[model samples]
Target: MLVDLFDFALPPERIALRPAAPRDTARMLVVTPDALADRIVRDLPSQLRRGDLLVFNDTRVIPAQLEGTRGDARIGATLHKREGPRRWRAFVRNARRLRDGDLIDFGAGVAAAARDRADDGSWALEFAGDEPVELLLERAGRMPLPPYIAGKRATDARDADDYQTMFANEPGAVAAPTAALHFTPDLLAALAAAGVDHATLTLHVGAGTFLPVKADDTADHRMHAEWGRIDAATAERLNTVRAAGGRVIAVGTTSLRLIESAAGDDGVIRPFEGDTAIFITPGYRFRGIDGLMTNFHLPRSTLFMLVSALMGLERMQAAYAHAITRDYRFYSYGDASLLLP
Candidate 1:
């Protein structure tokens, strides 16, 4: 299929700059194969049955954005995937200007020094501190806000809370599993009371999650790799749920991708601890995940393509059209949708 098929017009006004007050009070759009229901996230439990299992991605967003200059070229960079504690793969604004052997310095008081660029146009930066590089990123790095938002102005401290999931734990991700952003502890407790079971898997979301589908033919597209892990215990729990005929409801595309990547054709899941570049698109049969809970994504992005795989491309396009018409918010801190294939 052509990537352009997923294109649609989303009003700039619908792109939310901030999160909703009290979090879980945000809107939810539930779509079954036959019907579509508009509801609030607080009413999520009311939509679930007794035996479904909810799997969430618990990887937290780190302070991945860095502001510095390459000689006279001012650039904004987002540290995406970590190659090591000190080395990482990053996306910068003026990627061409920052050549190999060039040093881009962040302002004073920060303990860091930039290194030469890799052949791929990414920097190989190292830090100067007694603490670990991860620890330093927590202290000196800024929120890795998306380009759409950063274009408006600089990212502030407010994004410390806004650009993360409520269940954020293992920090390495440059981006949040946004569907989990609407969840609050109270709402999760409410789901538990309603007999919904929760499971967690870790998929460190990379800056690649923000990459657009540049290929004209979708089959030609290459997926970006990101670190993901499903421990033996979590896999066993999910497999047990499946044996009991329970639905596997993935909370985000990250979880859905990781679960499907780790499961066998028979739908049995096993422990997985490594990087995966599983690109999901339409026509792929789901080995796991009966339904998905995710935020609205970019028009021609890979995320939208994954949603197309679960729900039909035509159907998903209709849904996006509906969302646009209804003034539904789009992207990271936006409202969510529950899709049943």
Candidate 2:
């Protein structure tokens, strides 16, 4: 399908620069197969049945943005994937100034050598020293905020906590699973009391999620791979939920994609580990998840395409139109939507 088909006009003011005061206070637009309702995140537990399970992505956001100097040229990089304990694949801003084997010096004694460059213009960088790359990043890196929000204002200390979800534990992701940011301890207790069971998986969301679709057609777009894991126990538990005739509700697109990647043609989810570059588009049949809770996405973005595939293209367009008119927020720090089709 033409990528232009997913395009929609969004007013700049509708983009949220900051999250709601109480995370659960964010607005949630529920789009069922036959109806649309306006609600808040705190109202989620009541939106579904007792036996339904909500799958959350437990991957934590890492400080992936870095600034350095290479041969007197200022360079910026956002680490998107881990190649090894000390090696990473990153998208560089001053990439033309870098070459294979060239060393770039990030301030505070941190440095890395560019090992290789991909056809897509990303660089393979291997950090210097053996103090654990995570430690090096802690000293030289900054939060990798989505460009939509960062472009409008500078990222600050508040974003350090706001960009992460309550379920964050395993560290690797460069980007936050925005939809899960609406969750809080109070909300979790309420959901449990409401009889909504929850589970967790890991998908290290990469900076690729913020990349724009340059392809004219959906078939030409190639999704960048992200690491994810689902243990045998979790898979069995999810299968059990399905067997008991309960719905599996994915908390974010990250969780939805990972679960779908682990599901078989027979719709049974199995233990999975490693990378997934699953690109969901219209006409794709979903097998693992019954519903999704995600943030409002960018125009012509892959996320919008995925939601369009979940619901219908026309229905999502209408849903978005309603959201816009009602003054709901948009993007990573924005409001959310509950999509059930």
Candidate 3:
């Protein structure tokens, strides 16, 4: 499919710079086959069925954005994936100034040597110290906000909490699974009260999620690999959910992609632990998830294409048009959408 088929115009003001004050108060657009309904995130319990299970991504966002200098040239790095305990793959800004073995100092005694540039132009950065890289990032790094938001304003201390979800525990993701950001302890209680169960898996969302589909056709595009894990117990439980006539609704695209990656042609989900570069587009068959809860995505993005694959492309286009006219927020720190095909 031509990438232009997924394109749409979005007003700049529609981008959310901050989250809703209470988080759950953010608007949610419920897109079903028949109609679209406007609701709030707090209304999720009422929207989903009693036997449905919502799968959440437990991967937590780290302070991965770094600004440093190599000689006289200023450089920026956003750690996207963990290659090892002391090594990470990062997208470099001002990368032309970097060499294979040159050391870039990120201040507060944090420095890394760059090497192994990939075809995507990202590099492997090996830290210089014996201390944990997490500790080093805590000292020298700030939240890696999406460029759409960061371009408008600065990343502040508030982002340290706002960007994370209630289910965030396993630390590794550069980007938060924003769909789960609307979930709070109170909301979870309501969901449980409504007999809606929840489970978690880890998919460390990378900065590559924010990268554009530079290819003109969907067939020519390649997705960046992100590490994810689903344990045997969790896999068994998810399969049981579907077998028992319960719906398995993924809370975000990250969860959905990982679930799909773990599922077989027969639609049985299995234990998985590794990198997934699954690129979901229209005409793709969904074997694992019954529904999805995600944010409004960028125009012509792979995410939008994924949602189009879940629901029909034309249906999603209409739904997005409805969302825009309704004044719904967009992107990370934005409103939500519950898509049921």
Candidate 4:
């Protein structure tokens, strides 16, 4: 399909610079097959059925954004995928100034050598130290905020908390699962009271998620790989939920994609742990998930295409139009949308 089919205009002022004060107070747009409803994030329990299960991505957002210098040239790096214990694949800003063996020094005694460049222009960076990369990152890196948000304002200390979800435990993701950001302890209690169960999987969301689809056609686009894991216990539980006639609703696209990657054509989910570069577009058959909860996406983005695959392209276009007119927030720190097709 033509990428332009998913294009839409969004007002710059509609972007949210900060989250709702209480988190769960954020607005939600519920999009069903035939209707759209406006509600708040705290009202999720009432919106979902008693037998439904919400799958969350427990991947924690790390402070992966780094600014360093190789000689006189300034280099910026956002570590996306973990290649090894001391190696990571990162997208660099001043990549043109880097050579195969050039070492860039990030202040605070952190430094890494640039390795092989990929077809996407990202390079493998092997840190130079015996210290755990996480510790090194903690000393030298800042939160990897989306370019849309970071372009408007600087990343601050508040983002260390605001960008993470209550379920964050496994630290690796460069990007946060924004849909789960609307969830809180109180909200989870309410959901439990309503008999709605939740489960978790790990999908270390990469900076590639924020990359725009530059290809004119969806067929020409290539999705960057991200690491994810689903244990046998979690897979079994998800299957049990569906077997009991409950709906499996993914809390974010990250969870949904990982679930789909683990599922066979028979629609049974299996334990999986590896890199996934699944690109979901319209006409793809969904096997594992019944619904999705996600934030409003950018124009012509793969995320919008994924949502369009779940709902129809025209339907999502109308839903987005309504969201825009209703003053709903947009992007990684934006309002939520519950899509059921």
Q: Is candidate 1 or candidate 4 better by lDDT?
A: 4
lDDT of each: 0.84, 0.96, 0.96, 0.96
Per-prediction TM-score: 0.94, 0.99, 0.99, 0.99
* lDDT (tens digit, per residue) of candidate 2 on 1-341: 99999999999999999999899999999998799999999999899889899999999999999999998999999999999999999999989988899999989889999988998999989999989999999999999999988898998999999999999999999999989999999999999998899999999999999899999999999999999999999999999999999999999999999999999999999999999999999999999999999999999999999999999999999999999999999999999999989
lDDT of 3 by residue, 97-118 (tens): 9989999999999999998998
Winner on TM-score (1 vs 2):
2
Tell me the spans in candidate 4 whose CA falls farther than 4 Å from its real position: none
For residue 214, model 3's alpha carbon misses the true position, in angstroms, by 0.7
Candidate scoring better on lDDT of 1 and 3: 3
Q: What is the clash tally of candidate 1?
A: 0
**Candidate 1 TM-score, C-alpha based:** 0.94
What's the lDDT for candidate 1? 0.84
Candidate 1 stretches with Cα past 4 Å from truth are 70-72, 109-120, 128-130
